[model samples]
Target: MNRRRTSRSASAEELLSTLQHLTARAREEVGLHQARVELAQALQRKMLPADLPAFPGVRTAARYAPARDGLDIGGDWYDGFLLPDGALGLAIGDVQGHDVEAAAFMGQIRIAMRAVASTVADPGEVLSRTNDLILSMDSSLFATCSFFRFDPVTRELSGARAGHVAGVWATSDGRSGITSDAGGLPLGIQSGQSYPVTRRTLDVDGAFVLLTDGVIEGPSLSIGDGLEEVRRLVSAHAGASAEELADRVLRAAGLTGHEDDAAVLVLRNEIPSREAASPDGG
Candidate 1:
């Protein structure tokens, strides 16, 4: 009996040792995963623009929110810049994933679009060329995008869509509606897909808004309802600054608990007030 008891004690010690070893390995794996996530997040932030370009009579602002339920990063991105011909170029897109690979692809797409838009004046041509470039890449990922060119002098807002959600616009007189732009397939789907351009004019004090589907779609909320909510918000807050309106859109969508990533871009045409433009307050 004494020999049997000693043998049992030895077996129990061996089992405890194995359990401790497994526990330490698991902790190490978790720490490694966390470090990787932090690094990816930093890299993703660096790819996006620090500030949107603003020009006379047009103010721009954007907001980006990452997925709340995952360790992986998302592909949603937005950009605004000046083209060679002096028009303001605005773009928003979503790559087809939520991983480190997706973030890297997002950066590549953004850069390619910028390079093409710098020389191409037409939004459709810009997307078409970018589509070809994406097809030439080694990855099989696809992306949806909306590209716009706004002429501040003429107030003409023209754009093209590539399987992207339509933008929303609100006029100074409270008229608001969703855009009806025709679109082609998402980029990288085919070799020669052509995006069509849609054109509209922005009334003074009007605003145009762009966003990714993550801002609207949720488990219980339908996309239609979400879009309607955004439309109403834009109409109601027509007087708000572009910055404030962008924030209100996110807060109204209850973005804190959203499962997917979200991004919003607001471009408002603000004519200088006579009093402000004048030397004296008249």
Candidate 2:
């Protein structure tokens, strides 16, 4: 009987020890993940523009949301900057995966994309250059991105997509459409694949909605349902300011429990009535 008791005690001790070791390891992993998330968030915040450019004839608003709950920052981002010819560069991209490494890679790709965008005159060329840069990087990672150069004065929005999510364009007449093409593979997947450049002339007071796949890839809903919800929200809030529209879209996405990193960029036409608004003679 004494031997049996001893054996049981030894077995319990061994099990306890193993449990403690596993607990410790898990704690360490959690800490490491937290650190990685912090680092990634900092890098992403730094890469994205703190303030939208003060350009004439256009109003812009951007919003980014991490997952509902977690320390994992995803690779979803947006960028807005002024081009040489008084045009506004509006872009949104999602690196193929979500995590610290993806976010870091996104930062690098973003800078390279901006540089390529600056040198290229057309928005399509900008995306082509950006895609090349992504393909040249380490072959393991992939990403999806979209690029656009919007001329507020002319109401022309020209852009391209590299396997990114479809874009939303809500026209002044209350009709809405999606801009998605089939050819371009996700950036970083293959070399020499090209994204077709598409252009749309904005009607009076038009708006564009750009987002990450995360917006549609939530746990509680399908992509089509999420999109329809977004469409409803945007339609309800159509006349609101750019910032308000962004807030509304993000709020709707969040309320729906989107479990992935998400971002939205709302570009609206706020053209001036008089020609004097554009000093550069556009």
Candidate 3:
């Protein structure tokens, strides 16, 4: 009996030792995973635009949020800059993934789109060229994007979609709707895809919004409902500043606990009031 008790005690000690070893290993793995997540988050932040360009008569705001439930990062991105001809160029896209590769691909696509937009003024052509560039690459990844060139002076806004979510627009008089423009396949799918362009004039005080699908779709929510919710919010708060509008959209989308990354860009056409535009106060 004494020998049997001693054997059982030894076995218990061995089991405890193994459990300790496994616990330590798990902690190390968790630490490494956390470090990787931080690194990927930093890379994603670096890839995105640090600031949305500021232009007279136009107010722009952008927001990016990572998935709330994972260590991996996603590829939702947005960009705004001034074109050579004084038009405001805006873009939002999502690469197909939730890892470091997706983030890197997003950076490459953003750079390519900017380079193409610099020489190509047509929104449709810009997307086509970008598609060509992606197809030329050695990657098998695909991306969806919405590109727009807004001429503040003429109130003309031309946009093209590449399997991306359609943008929403609100007129100064409180009319709002989702864009109905036709779109082509996502980039990297085919070499000769053509993205159709949709052009409209944004009246003074009007606003346009672009966002990734993650903003509208989730585990329990359908995209259609999400879009209608966003449209209602925009219409109800059409007079809010661009920044406030962006924040409201994210908050309403429950981004704090969302499972996918999301991005949003808001552009508001603001003409100075007669009193402010007048010299010597009229």
Which candidate comes out best when scored by TM-score? 3
> What value of lDDT does candidate 1 attain over all alpha carbons?
0.87
Q: What would the TM-scores of all predictions be?
A: 0.92, 0.86, 0.93
How accurate locally is residue 150 in candidate 2, as Cα lDDT from 0 to 100?
82
Off by over 4 Å in 2: 1-18, 180-183, 274-282
Which residue window of length 10 is worst by lDDT in model 1?
A: 250-259
**Worst 10 contiguous positions by lDDT, candidate 2:** 174-183
Error of 1 at 48 (Å): 0.6
lDDT per residue (tens digit) for residues 160-183 in model 3: 999998877776787999888999
RMSD after Cα superposition, model 3:
2.5
The local distance difference test score of each candidate is 0.87, 0.78, 0.87
The 10-residue segment of model 3 with minimum total lDDT is 249-258
Model 1 lDDT, residue 279, Cα: 67
Backbone clashes in each candidate structure, one number apiece? 0, 0, 0
TM-score of structure candidate 2: 0.86
